[model samples]
Structure formats: structure tokens, C-alpha cells
Target: MRRPLARSWTNWLLALGLSLSGHAFAAHAYAQFGDIRYPASFTHFSYANPAAPKGGEIVLVPPTRQSNFDKYNPFTLKGSAPPSMLGMMFDTLLVGNMDESTTAYGLLASDVSVAKDRMSVTFQIHPQARFQNGDPVLASDVRHSFERLTSKQAAPQYRTYFGEVKGATVLAERSIRFDFVRPNSELPLIVGSLPVFSAKWGLQGEGPKATHKPLDQMVVDIPIASGPYRLGPVQFGKDVTYVRDPQYWAKDLNVRKGQFNFDRITYKIYKDSTAQLEAFKAGEFDYMQSFIAREWARAFTGRAFERGELIKAELPHGNAGDFQGFLFNTRRDKFQDVRVRQAIALAMDFEWLNRQLFYNAYSRVRGYFVASDFEAKGRPGPDELALLLPLRAKLPAAVFEQDVPQPPQTALDPTSGHTLRDHLRQARDLLKDAGWTYRDGALRNAKGQSLSIEFLDSSGSMGRVVTPFAKNLEKLGIQVQYKVIDFALLQKRMDVFDFDIISNRTVGSEAPGTELLERYGSRSADVEGSGNVIGLKDPAVDALLDKVVSATSRPELVTSLRALDRVLRHGHYVVPHWYGAVHRVSWRAKAFARPADLPRFYQPEKLVTTVWWSPHASAAPAAQITQPAPKAP
Candidate 1:
């Protein structure tokens, strides 16, 4: 997760030419901690099969829980965009292979070099790289992309994500340099991951009559980019298809060789998982990854599954467990106190929910970085103390005095001496101490304001999951309302931090950096459309985030993250949920073939779109790839 820098792009552009020389050499690959896996001459990633045949179409549902997409521009804040567009239709300067944690190989850029002072990174664009219209990619286009993404017209999060980078400058027709505010190891990868698109995208009319729409207003304009696929067929809100470009520029590039095997990919939208599951059983799509344990266990059955026409498999991954939980917006005055937050969190009985609802398919999430080395364990060590001691005045006593906080447990395991009743009693006591007394059939604060909670979400599928938690909150005399709204409205409310509570899962990364700042930094807390969904504004947290991003080594990064984790866990800002170690996926048998070696970290959509291919597809097969859908207005 990257964050916006404090300074404006104009400031950085003016600060260019500060007398710094680029490094004497360049490399085909770069890594955060100086650990590069593949050599410069390597053919393709070990996880990809170069010989994989590619003419077939593979249909899949959106990996996320979105019901419909309303915009083609994903960078805007107003509406939900199709999840498939960014990855399929946009190209980045550098791309990271799934097998490696932090290493990046040049994609659009052929050579990359970092300044000796570490304040800048330069890239030489590939001359062969061309947009869908066959125009060559230029340094000016890279600069245009950076400026556009960091501008106010785009989502505010990008400004915060690229906040450290002063600005991008075109050194030559095919060369560009990005100047950072300070020396940081992660800055190179930060800028490298930038999604670059043609400057001509989203333009209407021609010559004097031409007009360029703001990113948010380009709702249906097809994006012109240098990606492997182009927007093919669309049914406005129901489904979208992507057709592989026959003249894709980097088809033979060393880093891209066996990937993006599908000639055509289609994504179907459904209102709910039940409908999606029925459609999958009816062969409406080729694959589905089930997040609901009950659906995977009880509902994924029929003659098609019995006869092995559909295969159910749990594919294990080494990626960190994504932090899924009920995030409390601290911006609200009702949740301002730490004790009140702590009291509310205790009402969630994860042990009961996992046993009764999830069918023991998950483990309780311990912290923000669960299942990763960054997750703080037991107590702070000497290194953590060295970092935490300086900010002790601004932090809570629990940061240093207590062990890492754990979710309240019940007597699901006999040895765990507590029960749900005991936990609720504890919650009641905490609420009382916080001046919230249960009277008038409600938990009222000293001013007689009833403590109310609205659990906001876009889908009703989580109604069952929240029911038990709501029941527990009701016991405390709290007014709990779980409202399910449309995705666009939900997004709009979330942007302004308008809800009391929302359940979200921040995707985990092997090498987490700038993204942490966006999620927890004080600078981002008040920024609308920012990733700081929790409304965290602690200066101590802000200090630690700087250290995490600027750390020079892997050990240093881990130590900083662990300390930060301990501080965040002590805040009690979230009601931690459960996570599964493997993906519960069911795909049509004989429809596709995958590589023998599984990448250590990947999502279901990535695996399906990137490395999997149809076994029977031919170069000139006579199959209609997709049904013509209604065009966008």
C-alpha cells in the first residue's frame, strides 16, 4: 500500500535538477532488500508454462463481492469499476512475479536505475511498447500518467500513495525520472508499480473539438493502454469480456513469456453468492472460488460434482492472511474512547461463530499482520523497545506493559477457562467503567446519548455472520442496526467516513510498506477516499510508519512492523475476524490446465487469468467467445 506525499507535484517538478547523478549501472530486476531471484537472461518465471496453449475462453466471476460495475475509470472515488480492467488493460513500468515477495522486473521499462543518493529512480521505456492504437510508449506518457494519478481529479488515495515522490520528469523521449522527497529503499518499487496508460485515453471528438473528461467523468470511455488485452464485449452492468490482443507488443518479452494464456476472459456479475453458485452449477461460468465455508461444504454438490465434471480443491498459499474484521471508524465521537471500543470488541465471540457458522474452516485473526513475520508475538524485544521507547509518551501503557492483545476467547476448547457468558459480563463491566450504564433499555453515556451502531455493508450475505454479534451487542443494551446498501452508495459513504462501522478485509502483502501509512497514518486519516478507513490519527503511529517505510534491511523492516502491530493491537480499533489457510475453489474439469508449480502468493483471479490455459483450445477455433451484451451509453 503506497500513500500520498505531503508536497504537491508542482513542488517536485520545480525541485528537479538538484544536482544528483544517476547510478552508473542499471539492472533488469530490482528488489527491496537487495535480494533478486531471477537472472537478467532468465526466460520466464518458474511458475509459468511457456508451452501452454492459449486460444480458449475462461469465464469467471469477480473475485470481490461487488454486485455491479458503474465506471470504466477505476482511479475515481465515485463508483465501482470493473475489477478486471486494471490488471488486464493497463501496463506498469515494472511487474512483480508471484513467486517473489518484493522483486520487480521491468515490463514497459527495459532498464531501471536508482540514484546513488537514493532520492530518485530512472527508467528507460521499451521502444517496442505500444498502446492499443499502435503508438509507441514515451517518457512524456509516463510523466502524464504520474501527474494524472496524483492530481485531485483522481482518487485522493493516489495523492497520498505517491505523496513522497515530488514529481516525474521526462529526461528524454524514452527515459523518465521520478524524484522522491527523501532517500528511501521502498520508493523505487513504489514508483515502479505505477500503472501507466496512454495520454490519449478517455478523449472524445478530434482536433479543435476534442475534449478530455475528468477521470471520474470517463464512465464508459474505453481506456487506451499497452496491456495484453483490450475491452471486448460489455453488457453495461451485468458482464464484461476482455479479448487478448493478437499483436500484443511484449508477447515474446522474457518476463511475460508463458503468462496471460487465455485468448478471451469473461466476468459475470450476480447479486448474491447463492445465485452465483446456481449459475456455476448450471455451467454459466467456468470457475468459482468460494469464500463461504458452508457453501463449500454443503451446497457444492450434484451429479456434475459426483461424476468429477467439476472439481473441488483447497489450494494452500503462503501469502499472509488478509486482515478481515469489523473496522470501527474512530472519527465518530461515540467510538472516540479506547475503552468503549474495547468493550464493543469483546461482544464478538469468534470461537462460537467459527464453530457454529464457519464450520471450523478458519483461525482467529490475531493482529493486522496475522500469519506473517510482521505480526507481533508475546512481548516486545530489545529492538522493538529501542523504537517504541522514544514514542512511549504518546502511546498507551499497554504497548510496553502488557503482552500483545488477543481476541476474547470462549470455552470452545475446554482448557480455555472462559465462556460466552463470562466474556459478556466482562464487556458489561468495561462499558460501565466508560460511563455507559444500561438503563432505559439502552446503553446510555453520561449525557444520556444511547450508544448506537450501524454495521454497514454492500451485501446481505454477511447477515448471518453479523446476527450473532448483533445479539451479543443487544445484551449490552446497545442499539445495533445492520443495513445493506448498494455498492455505489456504500462506496460513497465509505469515502466520507460516514458510517459507524464497516466490515472490510485489507489485502495482505509479503512486503508491506507505504500502504501501511495510508491505512494508519495521521496524514491520511482525514483525507476523503483514503485507505485510512479506521480514522487512525495517532502521531506515535505516524512516527513508526515512517520508520517502517525507510528501513534499510528485512530484519529492520520486520522489527518496525512488529512494534507498530503491537501499538495498533493495543488500540482495539477492530473486531478481528477469522481467516482460511487455503482457497476453497471449484472449477470445471477439462476446461483448463494449470502449471504444476503453484506460486507462493496469488489470488484465484490472478491464477485463472495469468497462468492457466485451455487444454483443447486451438489457434483458429470456431467457437463464439461471448454473447453480445448491451453497450454502455
Candidate 2:
């Protein structure tokens, strides 16, 4: 018999111990030590280095085009990309990590409990939690928010998530209860991560009707939130400002007691990243979130670094999820063969991309689900396996062993051409098995149809990465073509499932939830507005995902998740890409303070609204730590 991956009982015991002990080191159980740094004055708040800075109009540059906050309601927007940063600004309930860990720590609620049957969940509302307008947060508001979010008139995305909530009823002034048709252990985690809008504000109109106005008009003109910052002026093509909420709730919560220090958080919009970098160098912006590895590698050599205008801070890889390498348009007849998919995965030279483009700044991932605990290795020891077996029974064995490439003993250096050649040979073999034979100088099927693939890339950086894949495919007698389209057009094509293969990045969550359903469930495959863009559907995979959402204990959840991950990998649904294991962030050193315990990934939604304080401003003293009075019953 195979060794168990992890024992459910032992895993639970360990998790319980870690949660109760308040051990800082235990929080990083799965993380490996590299170049992660923590400032001496940093506290484990939502923001990093609370004492670093306090006042400045720090400008943040978003990775995409100017956000369409005015036209889109986050709850309704459905696409491959994560929710807009603006949507995150409007609400806060839960936060996610890159590795798929979703945490429920926020202003309104501290802890959430789901009963054994998963029928009902009780949220312990924070006593001090109040809306931006200084109105006490009531259970009625929570209920109202849910009701509106789930209503058909609201955005469809919000409605889909709340579909599981059979009914939401207010239990008391401070407690709201959710009744579900089936057991779902992930209920609390999911609901808590949803940003809660004031029912009064969101529902304002005749008889709960939703007015789909632009976000700037709804949020900025009349700002209302319980989060760290309130909406400010919207300067089209220039900057959007977020003013600190003076009467913000959670000001005294243990997790966020000393964060959100910036008086004004500004997002300076740029048409392209190169221009953004130029502005960062010119001190036009206070910080730059680096997506272009080549640009980041050359920053130090630029004029910006010589004058001490920029500081490169390496952040611990918080659990923002993976950037997936997808086998797009699975519905296309050309990609029906799994062998073909595997061949495509092998042909791409991620090693070269990492070295030449990324300057050896990233770590290649071989699996769909990245394991957090680096020490656990394969299956947990026998003792741990015993506890995991029951959960494993509900899932496929493939979860533990399928399609996982052997972990590299030495980090791959993309600069080495020898490694690239070996990878190429492996790819060719996989393709040959899939019925593509080299005839004359071109690869073709027995019927003489030439092997061809079109790579749809939306961004310049992704286009550059796909260019080399074309060469590798050509070597194997396969014709490959790449084209870059506008972001909007790409989105439209994705909606209709109209492409052969596309290269794009998806933000991973720290905790896996409905996203799994959206990506792999049969029900989601052709759902008109859902995110199962690749149209994957398998009963075994569905069963594993169901078990994951229903699992009550950590061990049970991990086992089910591991199984689901394995099946996806073995199926070659996605060709894995790279993660730096750290955030490549450059911020104005003197503009804002850093917090001690920073999230693995610094998402704009999570960081922009919280813990970003300006150094020159007079907000609150960093040491004024005090617990709020117990919430009233």
C-alpha cells in the first residue's frame, strides 16, 4: 500500500495547537526561508511597518488598463481575471493568498463558525464595527447585504456565490445566520471574504432596485464603507484618490490595530507599464508593483536607483495563488487529446523565459495546486496518513500522486541551454504518442492535416514569452502562430470560447473555494457567464471538489484538495508557470511604513486600503494599542 499523504487527525491537532499557541513561527509552517525580510519595527498587522511613514499622496499603478469601476459591479462581473481592485476598495470581509488560503480576518467579524452539518453558520460581529458613516454595524445590515447580493437584480457573480445560501436570516442584532441546502464547511470562509456593502447604501432606491451606475458615482460621490479608506475624487486618465476613513472600524482589532496610515492613497493610471515605470523613476508615483521581470532587473541600473528615489523590497511569498499556464479552448477539436496537451506543456521553455526575461527571479511550478508546507514532501508519515485515509476515500488516489513532476533537487537555471534541449526531446516524445508524425519537414496527422496552433496573447510581456514557444513547436514540425489583441477583445473571445490556445495569468487564492467549482465542475463548463473558460468537466474531479468544500477539518480539506489538484495535473489541464516565492515590490522608502506580518502576496485590494500610511502625516501613534470593549450581546 502507498504511504498516506497526511493524517486527518494529526493535521487537525497540529492546526488547533498552532491556532491556540499564538506562535508567530507556526504561521509560516509551510514557508521556506529565502530572502524574506522584516523590519525591526514591523508588527503583524494588515499593513507592513506601521511606523515607517504616515503622510503623502502615494500613487499606486494598477497592472491593467484604467479599471472600469464606473460600469462594472464586482458582484456581477464575470471573467478570467480576479475581481477589480476597485471592487476590493468598496468592501472588505475576507482576503486571499496566492497559494489559495482564504482568511476571514476583517473589520466586521473576528471568527466564523459553521455547525457540523454545515447547515448554519454564526458570525461573531465585532462590537466596534461601524460603517464609514459612523452607523453601528447591525446583523440586519449583514442580512440585507446578503439578500441584495443574492438578488437577481444585483450583479450575477454575487448571486452565484450566494446560491448556496438557502436562506439568510438575522438571528440577533449582532448575529446573522445562513442556512444551506447541503453541508459546506467552507461557508464561513467564503462569506467572510466577500466585501459587505451597507444594505442602506446598496439597497437605496425604490423597493431594493439596483441602479447599475458607475462605481465612481456610487462609491466616490457618496462614499460609505467599513474598510480602511473611503472613495475620493476620480481623475480620469490621471489618478484616483482614496481618503482615510476617519471613523473606520477595526481600528483596534488585533490584526489591524495599527495599520491604514496613509491619509490619501492615490492610484495613478497609465496606458502602459513602461510609462508607469518611467513615472516611478521620475518620482511621479510613490510605488510600483513589478510584473515585467526584465524591467525590474534593470531598475537598479537606471537613474531612479542612483538617486535613492526607489527602494526594492523583497516580500515573503504570501498566498496569492498561481499564474496558470492554460490549454485554452478545450472545446476545440484540435485539443481533445490529452497527449497533445502534455506535448504543449513540454514544448514551452519556461526555463529560458525565467532566465532571459525574468533574470532568474522566479520559481517554476510543476503542479496545479502548490503545497504550502515544503517539509511534508509527498504523503504525510504513516501516523498522519491514518487520519487522511477517510478523507482520501472520498477523493481519487490521483490527488496524491498524479501528474506531479519530480520536485527539482536544484533550482533550474533557465540560462542553461542544455536543460532546454532535454526538455524539447521530452515534448517531442509526448507529441509523437498523440498521433502527430513528421512527414517531409512538417508534423501532420495520418490524414495529412498539418499540426498548427494559434497563441492568443493580450499583453506585450506574454507575447514575448509565447514567441519562443513558436520556435520550439517548429522544431517538432508543428506550426505555431502568436497574435496580441486588445484586452477588451481578448475578454470577448474568452467569453465565447473562441480561441485555440491563449496565454494569460490568473491570480491564485490562498484558500480554494467556489473558484474550484468555476474552473473544473461539469456544471460550470458551458455556463454562459461562469469562469470555466477551458470547459473542463469530470465526475471524479467534481467529487473531489465537493469533498474539499464539505470537509470540516484541516486534514480532511487538504486530502480532498490534494486529490483534486492531482487529477487536474494528471489531466494536463494547465501547463504550470512560475512564482517568485516573493513579491517584487518597489515603494518610496520614506512614503509609508511597513507592517511586521505582511501577507504572502500584496494584493491591491488588501494593501491599498489598509496599512498604507504616509510618514509625514499625523494619523495615530503606532504604539497606541488597545483592545476594544467586548461587543454587546
Candidate 3:
């Protein structure tokens, strides 16, 4: 799922939406697409078994790590930290349903409401919700959390995310409200997902005598939060552990019932995927989500697996498989031309790569949102045309005249069969049309600049993946060089948008919200650290994004996103990569048990952590008969 735009923002901006009936009222859960699934009086989530026993450890080595996290805080940009820091250390106002895309049920806040004008969303904090140190979670604490996240002291991405919120207000003792700059349905949900922490977290003491230090300066101080788990032990870069809170508040809440079952959840850190997977095979860890196709196929086939000590399950879902591709940094003068980008895209033979390198584990990424309802198929239909017609003069003639652009398949001669050679010939025409002619044995533009691509990446294996494409570019008299560097240096370069080409992936979400602005907005195109790493700036894209955000219904959202997907595909922003429709997971057997039913759309890690609990007291993966991942939908 490392393809250009892989969808995993499910947990980042967790599920939300509401019943518009009677303007607004307190509800157990909110869903964007339809009626709420669980009733207000529901005992536990349908996906969770309330009777499942807890009290065993679940060990894991993640596919990636920030490495050497000195700070316990994840809100700031100064340093990196371990995963689940937000949810484990601090509890959000609402817990998003793992099964639903964006449905949110109250966690800390017992009830919530929004003004009819949508200018403000109010939440009534549960009196029972208490922090780790036994302090009540107050309305002021909620305000403090929101103010800190949106302030200049925090990460810039947070400012962009909560930009619509004017400010947080303490309406009363337990009631808190967030005032928005604009009245939008999404604003309430966004604010509802905020992680609430006690004000005493960074402050020294209670009342006016408390001395507050800047949050970014915290090196290794433990966070004072009210979540089910608190920081247990830390070993710097090696690993971190969370001990389940025995006196944790809201343990029996309807939304939280049967969730967070483990007595201790420890996330181990490894240098690379190879080491991590090896650690899992050796039983150093209990669970892993494998990212490498080769490892999944060949590496997990030892005696442990044969003896039922290990299990590999590919869980499938209907979540959108967003694009992951090689991005051309358009900020560079050489890559400004669309034709040149198209030629580069044409050179990446995913069809051949799938058969050879990937063992047919992935499908070629055709458009921005493949494997979902949002992807563009066939010619522009009448509904899509209505949206495109207004911008006809500003768009490409091909947008109206031709079918959407798709990467060429295997091209072979009937008698003297050859595939990639035909692709290279086609690429030659594109570069030639763009005035990059093969003269003096080099492809040079009219300005006398030789065409060269500098592919920058942190992964050493990426160089091998792009090697075949580079050779095809070389056949067209174009220079292609792969640069593999340190992860830290790569992050710095990526922040400043200082690369010719990058084999990068963007995290996508089920519901595309204001985050789209950070990824593709014109303002973020120049901002360092913004998600718009490709430096994409287009009026048409900007317009489409607006349409995407303003969509009012599921049907409207699909229509708008599909139209946006088509336009972005037409822009040739990247060379489509490959994506796996199902989540690849391998875990230790007989340690855990889960509900027979599974949520249709879910992040595998979230599901396991929350719903599954250990039946074996000795500590192992505590889940039921493994449900193998279904074929891609």
C-alpha cells in the first residue's frame, strides 16, 4: 500500500458525521452516509465481544518508525514519537467507529450538539471522565487542547487542519464549544475528533502558581492523560510500552465497551522491514502487517507457520485505494511541461513489473482513486460533463475529445514479439512533441537542456524498482539517475520540495476533508512540510477541490470526487504505481479471540488492538479463528 496515495488516514482523522434531524441533538453516534448503525442503548460494538477476556500483552514491530523519539508529545513538529501516542496517552472527545468510515460516538464528552447555523459545536464532558492523576477532565481542558493544537507553537499541519475553527470557548463547567470561521458540516466533526488532555500536562501545578513550559521543550516527560493506557516504560529508540490503566474511567462506556482489551500494548521499533519481519518470525513480536510482497510470499513459510504457531491473513475492504506513483516536482523548470511528465509516466511498465517483481500481488494504479466508487471509468459521462463544461476554455481539448489517459499495457509485435520496446517508441514521440529531440545522441529541449531525471528516495530497494523504468527512459536518450539517501536527510529535502522526482506515497482517507487542501491546495504548493510534496498548483485542481469539500450527500461526494479524480488524471501529475486492495497481515495464533462479524471498512491494526483480546493468559495474539482477507472488492 506504499503506492503514491495510499488510504490510511482512517485513524488520523477518525470517523464522524451526524443526524441532521431536529437541527441538532445529543446522539450516541454520528454517520455521514446514512442512519446510525448502533443504538444509543447498545451494550457494545457489533464487531467487539464484551465477554472477551483481557490481561495479556500484544507485542508488535511496526513497518516504519520515526526512530529515536525523545519527546512523548506527538503534537509538535520539533521531534517524532511512537504510534498511538495520541489515543493511548490522551482520549479524544469522541471515538470513531472502526467499522464505519466516519461515524463518531462520544468517548470523553458524554453528549454533543451543533448550532443550526453550524458556527459552533458544543460538547458536554462526562463527569466520570478523569485523567491518570485522578483530575476531572474539564471544559477548560478541552479548550486548552484545541488552542494548543491550532496555535503557532504546534505543527503547521494542525493549523491548516483546524483553520476553519475560530476558537474554542468554555460555555460552562462541563460544556465546551468550538466557534468556526465558516458554517460547514465538516467543521463540527473535525473538532469532535480533537484529543483532550488535562491542562496540568505541561504545567507544573494547580491554580495560578503553575508554571507552564513550552510543549516543544518536553524531552521525555510523561503525559498526564485519561485514556485506557498510560506510558509504561521507554528504552529510547528501541521500544516503548503502555500499561493498561486499572482505574481507567469510562471503561464500561457503551462506545468503549469490550475495546482496548490488552493488559499491556507494547510497540517495538526496528531499523528496517527485514529486521522487523525477522523479529516476528522469531516470535519476538506477536503481530505484524507486512508491506513487502516478496516477504509475504516466501518468508512466512517456515515450521512455525506449518505448526499453526503463525498465521497470514489478507483482510479485504471497500476503502479507496488512492494513487501511489512517482511524482515529478513541477517546481523545477525542466518538469513544468505536461508532455515530459507524460513521457516519464509512459516509461513505468507496471504490467511487466507486476508479473516480474511483485508476483502479481498488486494491480496497476490507473487513476487517483482506484478500487473505490470514486475512480473514473469509461469516457466522461453526461453528469461529469456538466461539471467540466463550465471550465472548457481553461481545460485541455483532450479532456473533451479523448478517453481518460491510462498507462500503456504490454505492447508486442504479432510475429517478432517485444513489449517494452513499443512503449519506448511511444515515449519517444511524446518527448519529441515536447521539443526534446534526440540530437547529438541526447534528448535535449529547444532551450539546449538535456533531459535528465533525478529520482530521490530513502529506501534502497526503490532504486531497483525504478531501474527498469530508468532504462526505458535511457532508450529515449533521456538521463535517469536514482539517488538513495538517509531517511533524515530525505525528510529535510522533501520538506523544502527539493527533488526532481520522488518515489513517494501520500496517505489518503475514506472521507476527504480539509486535508485535501494541505495535499493539493495552491497555498500549500509552496509551503514547506505541507503534504503537497509534488508542488501541484492548478486553478482547475483548486476548483475541483472546492467541489469535493462542499459536496452535501454521498452521491454528491462520489460525483465530485470522481470528477476531481478525472481532472487530476488529466493533469499527469504522477506516474501511476501499484496498490494491494486487501490489507496484508500475519499474526501469532491462539492468543486472541474476536467477534465473528467484521466491519466492512476498517484499518487492520485498529481492529486488532481494540476488538481482539487474549484468551491465553500467557500472552499472544488473542483473536478467534483467523478470518482470511477476502479478494479485492
Q: Pick the candidate with the highest TM-score.
A: 1
Residue 603 in model 3: shift from native, Å?
A: 1.7
lDDT of 1 by residue, 1-633 (tens): 322222332242234322233472367866776656677779999989998876888899986666788777888877777767899989999999887788799999998888877889999999899997889999998998899899888998898889999999999999999999998888888999999888888767899888767777777777778898887778887788888887789988988899888888889988776788899999999998888888788999999999999999999888898999999999999898888999899999888888888899899999999798899988899999999999989998888888999999888765658888888898899889889998898999989999999998787868988898999999999999999998778888999999999999887888889888889999888989999999999999999999998987788889999999999999999999889999889999988899887988888778889989988756443134422234477
Q: What is the lDDT for 424 in model 1?
A: 84
- Candidate 1 clash pair list: 1-515, 2-161, 3-160, 3-161, 4-159, 4-160, 4-161, 4-163, 5-163, 5-164
Per-residue lDDT over 1-633 for candidate 2, one digit per residue giving the tens place of the 0 to 100 score: 312333343354354444423222122112111111222232444334534444455677765553333332344444212123344345444433322243334346644555544476666676787886778777887876677666655544555566577877778788776778686656655676556766556344575565544332333233345766655555532455666655566654544555566666667766565666777777887776676678777753565566766677666655645656745668987688877877777777776677678888877765665534321235444543444455575544654543344322222664643465676677688778878889977988878888888877665667777778788778888888888776667767777678888665666654466667766778767765557777887777777667766765555665666655555666676666777666667877777655456554556445644655565755443223212212112
Cα lDDT, model 3, residue 381: 89
Tell me each candidate's TM-score: 0.94, 0.76, 0.89
lDDT by residue (1-633, candidate 3, tens digit) is 312222222331233344445445455554544335566678887888888777787887654442545567788766566677786667888777765665688888888776756677888999899998899999999999888887777767777888778998898989998888876656767888888887887887777888877776655666777888877656765577777777779889988788888987888876565666787889898988866677688887898999989988888776667568888899998888898888787787777788778888998788876677788876788888878888788788888788888777774343555377676787789888889998887899888889888988765667668889888888888888888776667767888888998876654467776778778888788877778877988887788777776655666677777778888888898988888888898889966677788776677877888889877676433233112112111
lDDT of all predictions, in order shown? Answer: 0.85, 0.59, 0.75
Candidate 2: misplaced stretches above 4 Å? 1-54, 64-72, 78-106, 110-113, 124-129, 133-136, 151-160, 202-224, 252-255, 318-321, 374-450, 507-510, 596-609, 618-633
* lDDT, model 1: 0.85
**Is 1 or 3 the stronger prediction by TM-score?**
1
Of the two candidates 2 and 3, the one with more favorable lDDT, higher being better, is 3
